[model samples]
Target chain A: MATFDLNDEGVVVIVGSGAGGGTVANELAQKGIKSVVLEAGPRFDSSDMVNDEWGAFQKLSWLDKRYSAGGWHGAVNHQNLPAWIVKGYGGSTVHWAGVALRFKEYEFKTRSTYGEIADANIEDWPVSLEEMTPYYEKAEIKMGVTGKTTGMPHLPWNNGFRVLAEGCRRTGRTDYDSGPMAINSIERDGRPACQQIGFCMQGCAIGAKWSTMVTELPQAEDTEYCEIRTGAMALKVEHDDSGKVTGVLYADAEGNQQLQKARVVCVAGNSIESPRLLLNSASAMFPDGLANSSGQVGKNYMVHTTGGVYAAMPEPVHMFRGTSVAGIVGDDVYHDPSRGFSGGFYLEFLSLGLPFMAAFMEPGNTGWGKSVAQGLEQYDHMSGVWVLGEDLAQDQNGVTLHDSEVDQYGLAVPVVAKTPHINDVNMTNYMFETSAQIYEAVGATDVYELPAYPASHNMGTNRMHAEASKGVVNAFGQSHDIANLFVSDGSQFTSSGACNPTLTIVALAIRQAEYIAQEMNAQNI
Target chain B: MNGRLSIDVYQAIADGVSAGADADEANATALKAGLGEVVAQAQALFGSSYVDIPDDDAREGILRTFQNEGFFQGVRWAAYFGIYNNPDVWLKFGYQGSSVEHGDYIDRGFSDITFVPEGPTLEERMAQVKG
Candidate 1:
């Protein structure tokens, strides 16, 4: 509730209050640094969440004007929606199923380990997994991840996960179980344990799941060091003569523009809007975009090589009875060039409800047939898994401001383009084959290899690297060109590992906050 | 429409096409503005008015041409969700909608799987792998 004046340049202005921005706000507030968090959507507490999938999607999803253009499945089937992230205060964290996974060591060092995957523009992360361990542990602890670090037991298996686990067992794959999740197994942080109510994607109605809405934002507000302005859509970041970001020009709730001055500006507007805002903020000093000296601001976009594999079992599975993402099968979550692909994938339990499956099936997006109806007829008998494979960075695949189109805010609309690499294609095929084998091994009546859905795990638009010449931001997510500006979201990802990204985004935000505080202490920016 | 239950017809077509609420806005706009042109195009393709199409197969063929059209996609998704998200349709799919009110499904068969065997615990699996 503490509000800062427009001329208060002492406070940092953080855009997009999701895992990254919200985490940075809380972490900085805890360090006694003040920040003004601007969320483009209205804030919602856990009680305001919806259990209906369509209802929550209508309420929380990012419905801004953007276009998808590429050869990928998303372009053909879902041309308007390349990335399906949330827009509310908690961002995608509100909608995320509590799958808290850490990147493997090799995942960070993909360039060295995978070594020349033809067209893949892979690079080693500036911060290695060894350096990130403590931060990862901190993030896990902060989110109350149910794993070895927290001493909280993994969530119990549901009928959907049991089907996949049995299939994994039958297929000789072992690293399968109800894995480390951020949802409460036993009430520890005042939030009740997950009651197995199942609508995790529809924003966790019971607050058992860790969302910045229920955790970071409220905590940051309580510290009296943060002022959160909901429905404040950032139009552009204005900079001083020295190329230092001085303030952000954003449209307030009433659609009138206001300038909130900043000591430092952090862009955590996920991948699309983060890059789009930077591009929109282009000036006479930085024509290409703010902090785009290397032309890497909106380059190398990667939405984890993803797909869904659902099987129609003989018996009823009732996949929607528990947590949405039930468990993970991580046998494939390692590097193996011998498999004709550079990186690996994980088969996580996924159970799409009747409405979703029917819709996404698109009747094959090819023919209007009875086949889809037959599949939906077996809704209770369905069990599924989502494939999260490592997607390589391609400079050709990124976000670009559309040539002539402007959105509701009158800013140029962002056009996200993706072209999967040969490695991605080969790896996806391997995923389908293996997933189909697993399902068929456990007596699946029919297996469906669905095309990729609108990506929820988007990364690498304002990527991190060791050197300024190679990337936009440094390891701390501080922009190389604009010292006072930072990228504190999955947008700064150097590479996309084959896992969920919220934990890593949180860990990086915490780490970046520490760096920002230290730099402030030293009067660096 | 094709001798199937009225609900099954929507499932056969598609749903979730209008995932974003903005898409719904655009779709609603297109539904009003583009319907006339779509009918005209359908008429030209079918050699008759859209409602006067003689056969389902011919009607489907004309529909295929406008598959990517804004009006077509909008109307289809709107119609599909109308039926599928309906409370009456929930019984057909055995969907237990919004269980938080009755409490979480922890005891109400969230873990119940009759066909699949109960697997070993995570500890047991780790121990076995170590061995």
Candidate 2:
């Protein structure tokens, strides 16, 4: 790994080394552009990855103190855990279940296509699917995503996914398959194929799944132009008088504050931390917060309306024997207003071990009680689908800094509140009914509808829009207020599509890198 | 860990709570604080110590009061991890842990995994339960 000097004012400082920041850094490095990547957590390679659920969770999950508020399940049952993101070098991509799907055309045109959704902060993305398709193709090939375009076969299904696939088949749904997964189906990209290890959420030990730790970060490092400094948590983005972000204030591994100078700053710290950093970076020039003139920096935060739908079959499913989410049911992924919701959802394969199933069945209740214990008694017979749906963005549902309460870092503790819109309710109810139908069609003994767990798909805080007043960034994730500043992550999403946002985030970062390099060449501030 | 329960049941709960104590100190503290709350609440509700309450339903009612508290959820998390993480409990639930070393469950035990073409009717399942 290369190291850049603290006073190196020529480097582009990219915060949060996840899919976005990592891809951007690597892409920029490929262009011979220098960058310093500041990652909040320690860098754990595949060798350090643990397979045990609890062990891996402690090792990878961002368990720092955060408060949840509002009428959602996270607030009621998981008040202290609003979202579950990784704080490591690769970020959530390390823990992600490699289910990659590109955004539909209408998904990018939410406001135009959905047409005046009530009480929703709906807006069309400035970039269309047409513009993003080429980048998505690049991302798919780069990440070894399994699909038609990538020319890579999808990974094999586990018994858990088999049950769901069989159910989908019995229900007359033909759009079901084993992939679009970024996890390798064959030995490619210097990484081995997935061995169906079941614990995909835990870091893949063989590096079969695409993570920046193995892919982008290493490529970036090999370029000798990108320095990924792990265990450096970004506190605030510092800017000069002209409102151009020039450096980053971060806590080093030893808990000492250090400022690394930069020519440009890209905030990719997910939806929560990205906005939280901006809100904390408030100055006299931008009194409310940096690039927050629209008052939307921390607003419209979305973790897709999600839940675990498990069915108890009469036979042992042994759902935890293969890749966690390679299988998906896409029959309900399109819009149909007759279904009483403007948007739709996808049912993807999910398997929770006994401990996790016991934890999330009804999170706030006692686990030893017969209610959940009985559910666990049939753990071997269970097959589940994780519903990722279109959760409407409401301005009130977002991340806000607590005035008095502070974290161990002495920064204000972020309070992430999410109130589900009625659209979410309607869509969720329909999702439940249709998902239950898929399971029941194949003779499921019982269908268990579990509420939302801590979100891994957190998105849409510093969104993109053409008008500066409507959003924080442009189509390219460039800050509307600050020319040199950018939001290069899922935080730049204008709408929360039903699909997983990693592919889009990676695609956006890849495209953003080109734009950034062009601006550097053009000598634009 | 509460003494209000009978010795046999109390031992099981105690074993679980003891196992749970190692999960995280925060969870253990929450559980201990909650037990303290339960003791006081039991006295207030029944004019007797929790152990001397002598009725399971009354004791359950007292415990239900703290269900929404952090301690309650913490205890739930601890107990589940404690109880479920136990290999014996896992065996009872027919769960196999950590599949990577076992050739990734590809060929072994991934085949002939049955799903009933048509499941047992409610009356049929009820008959099995009754039996």
Candidate 3:
């Protein structure tokens, strides 16, 4: 309701408030570095989270404003359509099912092992897992991630992990391990322990999940130095004659356009809108777009192509009893990598299909009178597992601004042309067979494999590289072309690991925040 | 004799044809006696605007005047009876009728939704249609 201004100490302005922006904001505020965050969604209190499905669906979820479009390639056309996207404080993390796992060490380098891909600009990352391990540790402690490491010989383990491991061992597949998750298993950080009501996709009513609404942004709010302006949609970044970022221009809640000056500007709009902002910031000096001299601003996107397997157990699993992701198995992750595939995959037994969504996918539903009743009867007996594998980097699957269409705010919408490589199919098939075996071992009847696709956990848009000619950002998540501009979301990922991207995004955001703070001190700005 | 010319023309010729007159020669003589004019009058009134025939609703309807009199229904019934005579029409509609639930759109990779072979005859389908 009020017009805003930058804090007096020339605060660093971050453009988003999800895991990446929230993580950096909390770290910056703790270090006594002045920072301000501009978020497009309103701030919601955890107390506002209601229990009923109807109330939760209407009040909390991001189902209304999401858009989709197909992408175009060098000489090919791609389909761009609309989809249900999230808005508000947490961004996609608001509706995320809360699966957390660290990226494997090998995920940082794809080109180094698999060789150059055809018609792709695939490359390795500047930072490795060892460099991010400490930050990952800090994020685990902060977010209260549950589960023991399962794939390798020795990793962290928890109760859920132990049960999955025992189940796997009983079936002669000794590779079942505990999965790491962001939900609060115990009463850590003043958040309540998990009651596991299984409605996390609709927003955790009990604050059991570590969403930004429960985690970092609140800490940022406590620090008076960080000012959070909600409903402030950043249009583009303004630059001075010297190619340095001057300030950002954004539209306010009242549809009034305003500019806020800051010493540095950080864009953390996740993978989709982050590149959209940069591509929109075309100027005389940077005609191809800001910080995009290498022509790699919105290239190298990955989604870890996923499919689901559903089986009917003898008894009702009541999968809605706990968090969405229960456990993971990587027995087939690296077992036969010498078979010529460049990557492995992980499968997690998870809760899927609410009443409405399940009814939509019901196999025997005739959409007539008595048939609808029969479909609802099978809801309790169904349980499913989601298989996520590494999508090798290919330049062909990239995002570009469309020539014709624009958003409601008169900004060009990004047309994403994504086509996963042949290796994606190989990894998906391998994971599918493993899932079928697990179902058979656990004595499941009536197993069905869901369709596969390049889904929405999009990563690696503003990728980080050691050389400026190759990547848009440096290892610290700072733009190599611009001194002060930084990116800390999944956009900075070099390669998508065989795991969910949220936990790793949090780790890298903290790692980058620390780097930014030290850089400010050194410059005495 | 005032405004009309009455010909004892077709009656005399038709009577002769019935009494062993050459039938083809009689037809040719009738055609020569202005039969084209009679057909031209019929075409001028009916042929040009068939699709726009008026119905009970103030707007032009899809069916012609004669079809609106129930001729189309008779033709449909004929087609349905034709299919009823041929049992293979059931398989033509892809209706195996084995565990096939009504309105089930998705097949579990087991069966496809296709035409029922030797299915309902056009006459039977038209009879089933309610007014």
Deviation (Å) of B27 in candidate 1 = 12
lDDT of 3 by residue, A302-382 (tens): 777677766655444444345556567876565245654667788776654343223233222122122332333444455
Q: What is the TM-score of chain B alone in each candidate?
A: 0.51, 0.50, 0.24
Which candidate comes out best when scored by DockQ?
1
lDDT of 2 by residue, A177-200 (tens): 777899987789799988877788
Tell me each candidate's RMSD, in Å, in order: 4.7, 6.9, 20.2
The DockQ-derived docking category for candidate 1 is acceptable
* Model 2 chain A weakest lDDT span, ten residues long: A364-373
Which run of 10 residues does model 3 chain B get worst, by summed lDDT? B109-118
Per-prediction interface RMSD?
Answer: 4.3, 13.1, 27.9
Tell me the deviation in Å of residue A202 in model 3. Answer: 1.5
DockQ of structure 2: 0.23
